[model samples]
Target chain A: MRAIILEQVDRLLAAQSGAAALRRLEAGEWPEELWEALEGLGLPLLLVPEELGGIGLGWADAAAVWQVIGRYAAPAPVAECMLANGLAAAAGIEPRGGFSSFGQTAPFGRFAAQLLLEPAPGRLALHAPGAATPGQNIAREPRDAMTPGPLLAEGALPNSHGPRALRLGHALLRAALIAGAVEHALALAVDWANTRKQFGRALAKFQAIQQQLAVVASEAAAVSVAVSAAARAVDSRGLEGASFEIACAKVVAGEAAQTTAATVHQVFAAIGITEDHELHHTTRRLWSWRDEGGSERAWAGEIGRNTLAQGGAALWPDITARDIS
Target chain B: MRFELPSLPGGSAGLRAELRAFLAEAGRDWTPAVRARSWMGFDREFSRELGARGWIGMVWPKAYGGHERSGLERVVVLEELLAVGAPVGAHWIGDRQSGPLILRRGTEEQRRKILPGIASGKLAFCIGLSEPEAGSDLAALRTKAERVPGGWKLNGRKIWTTNAHLSDWMIALVRTSPAPEGGSRHAGLSQLLVDLRLSGISIRPIRDLLGEESFNEVTFDDVLLPEDALLGQEGAGWAQATEELALERSGPERYLSSLPALTAGVDALRDVPGADVAVGRMVARLNTLRGMSLSVAGMLEAGEAPAQEAALVKDAGNDFEQRLPEQIRALLEPEDMPEDLRALLADLTQLAPTFSLRGGTREILRGIIARELGLR
Candidate 1:
């Protein structure tokens, strides 16, 4: 299964090279081919039940796909569609085929055929694009906003874990994305160190560069491990006891994204800052995703409140007692 | 991908509960200051009690006094021991690396002699890797073991040898021969097991920042050993040391050092304004570190040498543990802190500086990680 995921990822990345991706972003192209390829692979419907004509992959499996998409900085609604299909399933709405976007404010909102929204707790609704005021995240990917009114279908999201779960799920996916991008950034840095020579030796041989790249590697490893924990927690507890893990994972991912992106840029120096260099593809998404689900600082506060609420002796157990089911 | 941190295997839950029960009973009287030592707190009686319960060397073969438990079982025991701040330090080095090294490299006689004692917690071991002049550059060590009639005559000085003053034995990496013809510095180094009680060996304590003498400088002058003292093939110490160092660098001990203080701080400041935010951030970071550490444990269990991944964990773990006290202090109002909490903070603050210096220094760990990344 992982091999299949990796193969699909390789194909997608090959199709949308950094040059093609940057061109699409610059030209404000809709990434139609990218979306088409992902849809062809049924990547977005991974979380939906097999009964619903979906693959029914678990959270970890979907997250693996997100990690690969994040690595290539593929500007598509892959994460959103996965969440939307799940949300629609919970709401007793049959998710239609096409690009679907779900969030407080949807990404690629203008391009989405259907937008799933939770304007308030327990309320689930679908809306046409209606009007998507085009906006871009820090990475210049689409994060357009649309008015919540004039819903095409509206009802209470029965059996749903509620808006918080959706948000947590999105946060978890973004963490995976940032993790993937950091993986790319670290690879780039390693390649630069090995190939870019100075002082009659590879930059990698220098202690300074190695130390910096080591930090990047640590950050990458941390986010990768952390996101898995969060994914597993949500899978088992259904967000009832998942907030702590989710918040912690988000904070770690956010902080890692910031630190690693900056450090990779420092390692690459002048060339890293230019758009022509592919480092920006990953680094910029890192900048954008760290803030997307919720900023690290925001999640830190959430984690802090939860910890203090649990009081003293229950703290460690709460951490160690994560659901492995 | 299956690259995710694998969940704990079955039977670990029962082991975790068993350990928690034991800790609740055994650690009832442990003070916050003592608990702050975490894995470094040494108590021989406590260690022996754990051994009697078949906790130490839980995964080794039964013939060598082991329980033949799974790696996750051992992880559960160690996790509980560190979490509640048990005094496992008496057998920490032995059970963690020394016993494992001997089990892997020692001859049948050596294993028979050493393994049972370590599993029983009656024997303790200390590492003798870092020398005064060869701290991070271990291959540059000048410790010489000249070949003799019966065995080897050892003469060298080892610095920062943790628990040396209290240990019964040591696995010393020493120079057995000169650099090879091709100038490979790692060649000709070998691991030698030395009895701390041997004549011509002196151990002097080095006071750490907290004024505790957990570290020592051991000087060996013409110490004689039988042929059995040599571990593994001669002139292969570098490879053996690499494996030993991996075990040393990857354990939960690396990041759990300052956890006691952090936990106490959270308890004391539970209702304080914005306390959650501070405690939450630390918990988040701690959870992440724990995940990374456990992943490494899983890798080891699968018989994979994730040396670079282990190095990454140690580098990050050291940084997290060292900064924990200061970060917690900044989180809470100083004047509002209780006396017990303040003492923990102060003790950890004093001990924090040594966190990165021990095992492998941060720079050296990072260098190893970079080398694995194909950077060097």
Candidate 2:
């Protein structure tokens, strides 16, 4: 089952390589063909329940697809769609899937078929992307802000007054995406360091370059593990209790993505910054994703506040409680 | 590609609960300062208690007093111990590296003699690798041992040897012969087990900034060891030592040293605005570091020598551990903190510098990782 999921994602990512994604972004267009292919594979319904007309995979399994999409910086709302399907499943709504965006403020609002908005906890209003004032994020990705209009469908989620689930779920999604991009960025940096030479020696032969690459590699590795743990937390405990681990994953992965982007790009100097290169696609998305999940400071504040609330003695148990086997 | 994490083994939950129960009672009296030391806090009685439960040498064969548990089980126990600030330091070196090295490389007679003692926690061990001039560069060590009638005679000086003064034995990496012509710098090195109570040996405690005498410098002047004391083959010390360095680098001790301080800071800041986020941020980083470290343990359990990944974990773990004190201070700087929290922070601040210095320095660990990445 894991192999099939990875192979399926790998096939799509190979079809939509980094270069292709970069071109689409540069052309200011979404990859309709890519979205169509993923939707044809029932990709967005991965996290929805089997009873809910979806494959019923856990958040961890669903996250693997997002990681792959982030690896190539796939120019589609695959994450948004997956998230929307998940929310819809939770809300007992069958998402008539196309490219859908779900967030406090959904990006690519102009391209989405339906927007899942959680203005308050437990109450989700499905609506068309109305009044989406056109805007672009730092990465030039479609990020139009919108005031959620009249609901197409609305329901009260049980024990949903607190939006911890949405907040933590978003953090988990962004963490998976950021980790994937950072891993690829590190791989690219390693390739550059090992093959690129200066003064008749490979850049990797230089201690300075090696150190930088090493730092990025560590960051990438750290982010991957953290995201994996967070995914597991969500898989086991649901969002209500998993927020601490999710917030941790977000802060750690977010911090790592920022450092990794700077270090990996700096290792390439001018070449990485060029439009002809696909490295920017991953780095730009990293920049966007890190900020998307409330940024490091935002999540850090949540974690800090949670820890402080527990008092000093209970801190160990809080951390140990997440030690899943 | 190797970054894919391995799954934690089954039965870890049961082991974790057992350890937690033990820790709750054992560490009931430990203050934050005692907890701040975490794995570095030594208590002979506590170590023996763990040994009695067969937690030490858990992966070795049952014949050697081991419980024959899986590597992941050992990781679970160790992680719980460090997380709860258990004082297992008296037997930490033995359980973590020395005993494992002996079990793998020691002869039947040597294992029979040493392994049971370690497993019983009756024996304590300390590393004798670093010299005054050979901190990061192990091959540059000048410690020498020469063939003698019944065994070998050793002469060397080891610095920054943790717990050497308290340990019953020392595992010394010595130059058995001069480096061969045009040979690897690592040639002719051997690991010899030395009786710390040998007549010719002397141990002097070296105080750190925290005024702790846990670090020591030891001198060996013509100490004699039995023939079987040689671990593995002579001149195979470098390869042998490198294999277990993963065990040293990937343990929870690498990251959880400063957690007590952070947790205390969390308690102190509970009523402060935004304290959840502030303390939560540090907790989040720590949880991630634990995940990364646990992944290394998984790799080790699969019998894959993930030296580079272990290096990555240690490098990342050290950075997190070292920065934690300062990060907590920065987060809670505006608020007037309690006295206990203030004291914990001060202690952690002083000890944080040692995080990257011990095991392998950050530069060296990164260099190893870079080399493994095919970068060097």
Q: Residues A206-257, candidate 1, lDDT per residue (tens digit)?
A: 8889898888888888888888787777666655357777788889999888
TM-score of chain A of each: 0.94, 0.94
Best by TM-score, which number?
A: 1
The residue-by-residue lDDT of candidate 2 on A1-325, one tens digit each, is 7569879888877877667666676467877777788888888888888887888888888777778777777567788788877876777777676777876467788777888877677777788767787787777888788766667776554453146556667778888888888878888888888888889998989999989888888877777777777777777767766777777778988889889989988999999999788788888888988988678889888677556556777776667666665
DockQ of each: 0.73, 0.63
Stretches of candidate 1 above 4 Å error? A148-163, A323-325, B1-3
Candidate 1, Cα interface RMSD: 1.6
| All candidates: TM-score | 0.96, 0.92
- Residue B368 error, candidate 1, Å: 0.9
Worst 10 residues of 2 chain A by lDDT: A156-165
Q: Which residue pairs come into collision in candidate 1?
A: A304-B276
Weakest 10 consecutive residues, lDDT, candidate 1 chain B? B1-10
Q: Judged by DockQ cut-offs, is candidate 2 incorrect, acceptable, medium or high? A: medium
